[model samples]
Target: MPKGVYLRRAGRFAWLAFAGALLATPVYAQKRTATPQKAVQQQPAALTIPSDPDDAFVALREAARKNDADRAAAISATLVDYPIPSYVEYFRIKSQMFDSSGQPLIDTPDAEISAFLQRYQGEAIADRMRNDWLLVLGKKRDWANFDVQYPQFVLKDDTQVECYALLSRALKGQNVAADARAMLVDPRYYGDGCVDLISYMAQSQQIQRGDVAFQARQALEQNYTTLAGKIAAALPDARVDGDSLATVVKMARNDPSQAAAYMGTISGNLSRDEQGAAWGVIGQFAAKKLMPEAAGYYRRQMDLGGNQWLSDESQEWRVRAALRQGDWKQVRQSIESMRPELRAKDPAWTYWYARALKADGRGSDAQQQFQSIAGQFNFYGQLASEELGNRITIPTRTTVSDAEAMAMRSRAGFTRAKKFYDLNLRFEGNREWNWELRGMNDRDLLAAAEYARKIELLDRTVNTSDRTKAEHDFTQRFPMPYRDIMQRATDDVGLDMAWAYGLIRQESRFIMNARSSAGAHGLMQVMPATAKYVARKIGMTDFSPSMMGDPNINIMLGTNYMSMVLTDLDSSWTLASAGYNAGPGRPKAWRTSLSRPVEGAIFAETIPFTETRNYVKNVLSNATYYAALMSGRPQSLKDRLGMVAPSAVTTTSLP
Candidate 1:
């Protein structure tokens, strides 16, 4: 979800007035529906042999919307002789993905599917069509087709396709045990396909008796108690009954250690694995609470062998609590016990490990670790650079030659992506651009991004630049496209331009027309109601809905409100960011219990709303990076965070 997405949801009903008080909204190409498509009335009996392409296109969409496949197909047939836009092709493909009866349209000729893919090679809708086609193929047990198409699946984030791939592999007598373990741990992604894969693996001896309990522990640690119970029920050798699991869960809710002690009552009867799993779940409860006794609770159970999942989580939160209490020694010990593979990738734990090393008089070793992760982008990565006694620095920009730029621009995918942008179809444009970069090396990616910059596609340029790993181009990464507008907004509101930039980057990735699913509008994702209120408050004349996506209007209104919240929260950017995201009411309530000033970092970690906590971190961290880019000097994240103090009571909900 985009930042402030939920905030704008309720305000979507606000009337959007176009030019001269005309209430109009653009109609988007939605996914196919089950209802039958409806045809338009004939233009005139004699005049209408067939409407022109544009007129035919409108009728086609209506037919598609009505789920009248036959009529839509007829209209789409007329489009064959006309020069239709890419979206017309998209609707044609979508209508074929699913029929009006709500069943996936399988048995379509493979040649036709292949032809569509070839025609829309670089379009976002192409991948969507291919995904649906692959699903149909997989269902029909056409392994040869599935195998050929699976590799071309650019965004392989689809768990069902992954599961189907595994199934295909297993049927071909391939070993997918390692892949299954990595992919199946998260219950959230499980669907009909993944579940079937799991069931097949279980029956095939790939899932052992021990693996069952391990999965149960994995489920429990993630707070999916029902999934955990299901795992336990399925395990043939489990000693613990359903009733005991319930009793233990209730106990764990109060104090994790208490739950651990209760496990002792059945210690003699339960297996070692069961004991470990129960203890692991208990530790999760304790670590999450960050109770004073959390460290001891995990420390005493260090030798327990349980689900590898729970062990990792238990250690992570133990370190989190230890860090909060300034217990460097315990933090080091907890991280040291973590799996090497997990520890190697986690920057947070690595940073803490370096801190522990420094505290223990091993500055040389700490510096070595810090040096490896420095210059990277992310919360912990920046912190690591600070520990190594260096500040964030922008990378030198590379010039793109005319020949190289032409070569990049000539690519079919990039051209299609650019076309989408020009048509104001940003969503489709972004998808197409991202898909085209799937196989490009870092240098190629940089070149493509430079080409995007040359074309003034600032949003795509920024996003494309983010894909580079071997190179860092801060100019492209933290672009200041609407510099003049932002300057005025910040200057008038007396707020930090870098901070505003940071918020906008996270809010909409600098897309001028970005609209979230929750109905947030424009670059800053301002709610309609909030925009209206701010418009009136600032005494702006002729405020209208047509101005939502206008970069100047959005930045001015957003920055002004930012200043308002900053002042309301006693100049705390941390709280202001949270207020901006989750609303000012929650932050005010969250601050009421602050008996004394607390570190912004600690308060952020403890924020009950996961989205707001993450939003605050991202905004502040981004601001830090932007500050480095703008000032050409190091900036302190600590100074930016400052200390958050309790708020004074105010009559108004939002300032």
Candidate 2:
């Protein structure tokens, strides 16, 4: 969310008027004339200096507010004489004076801003400065100046690849292209820029047909070698040739399968040091399930330099391989050699580690670990808790019964009957009644139809425009079956129905068997382990992994897991939501560290994860609409959700 700037008009006027009234009133006629006269006789008429910087700042702010340029300038000059950084003061002066209409002011000229930015070229603030400079450049049409500053601004390691493409388009000259190509090939751009450059080229149609294969081959070559080297170097007690190994590791990650294949071709070419690195690559690839062939390579690396890092990597792969093969002993030995840091960071590792400990007859230790993680209000936490015999309890709403819900659905119809009826009555032949209806998506339409239908059933007159919109929305993409499934899941888990819909929309677009690149499966994108636990808890025996793809099974398990998370998070829906998106433990950690009130917007804005932040918003917004529609309220989605200021509307309650 963006910050708001408010001008205290009444306060400013009151102070100014009070000062004027005081001057206009005669001292002789005032009741305190004698005291004032005595004070005038006793005191010197010199100006008093304030002891605090805050006072000085306040005076400056007042002067600026009054548009007293001379006083403001004097204050600025005086402040500049002090040793403190004047950036804030400079910003304030610029913000106040540039626009009488209260719009934000950009004080520096395009060229000057670019020059100022160059001084802090590689600093952390460079990105912000560069963005501001770009805006200025665009506004002022300083293409020539922009072309010059572009390369310098992009030298910062953190510069986004998008910046390069923007620069390329802005500076499409032959000379600029050559320079950009040089930058692309530089070792400094090898990090994220390599893939970014490829993507940019692909989007811009800059890469010719012949260059595609060549570029892909080059990427394959560099990444595979770099990945292999990093693994080798990170191995225990192995003398890494150089930083080239780390580079390869990152490169290999970009295209794991290709990198794994490249390892075979480069095998004979690798020196003893290089060979160890190659084995490391194989281990990483196998860990990602990218290339199982890398297993042999990892073993070979272990054979060459049986050090801790290699041993650790080897063991990690062994665990994965064992899990795939269901070899319990290999899983145990592999997990044993794993570093404590890996075990702590990865929930899967912790779960498996506990499993290994349990299988080895260390039940007490295993139970403790499992208990600590179980009852966590997230997928993994819920799984852990379920395994420890903590059953999740879902809360129920008493307002709507199953019969009523079924009746509402029946009225809404499988097609557009409910929508058409609602709209026809809402409009009542009044064509002019309309609303902007901002943020009205398909789900909103469904809610609106539901809301309108309830109103019409009560014989209330609704605006024609709103009714038309509701009907149009409902008929366009009902998502009724999907909505029904989600509602059921939410009800079953005692989760927010709207939030469930939102999650489904985001994760799978209401597709029953959606699978993400990260291996999150089904409507709620439940992980395999989470699904497995949920199935077991529900007394589902002989549950195939493929069962997770079935909507009914997925929703049952996902909702049950959601209920577990809600329980573990102490019934705080906000934390539960966060736990749902980002594992339960992280939200718990975040809550402890940042302790802000868990209001939807505040909590969402403060979320460190961008993905999770947006996820929360979409879910909450979805929930608001769902509640209003399902509950038969004719309230705006934002109003019901407490989004718009309460004072914006006359009534507080949903209609």
- Worst window of 10 by summed lDDT in candidate 1: 18-27
The worst-scoring run of ten residues by lDDT in candidate 2 lies at 646-655
Candidate number achieving the greatest lDDT relative to the actual structure: 1
The local lDDT score (0 to 100) that residue 458 gets in candidate 1 is: 73
Using all chains and alpha carbons, the TM-scores for the candidates as numbered come to 0.77, 0.31
Give the alpha carbon lDDT tens digit for every residue of 1-655 in model 2. 0001111233422334422432342320112123554445334332232445545555665565653334555566556544222332433333333333332233443444545465645432344456444434432324555556566554344433433434445224222334344344323234332433333343334543223322332333334444232223222332233334333455555665665666566656555645564456556555444243444545566555532324233445555644433345545666665656555665656666676687778888877877877643233454455557654322221122334324434321211223323333222111111121224453343344344344333111112112332233312121334567666777766676655654565565454545777788976788887788778887889887788878877887778887787677666556666778887775565554321232234344345565885676556544544444465553232222232111111111100
lDDT of each: 0.69, 0.46
Per-residue error for 520 in candidate 1, Å, reads 2.3
lDDT digits (tens) for residues 304-354 of candidate 1: 654353545655666765655566787788788776666876677787789
Candidate 1 TM-score, true structure as reference: 0.77
Stretches > 4 Å off in candidate 2: 1-478, 482-490, 595-598, 634-655
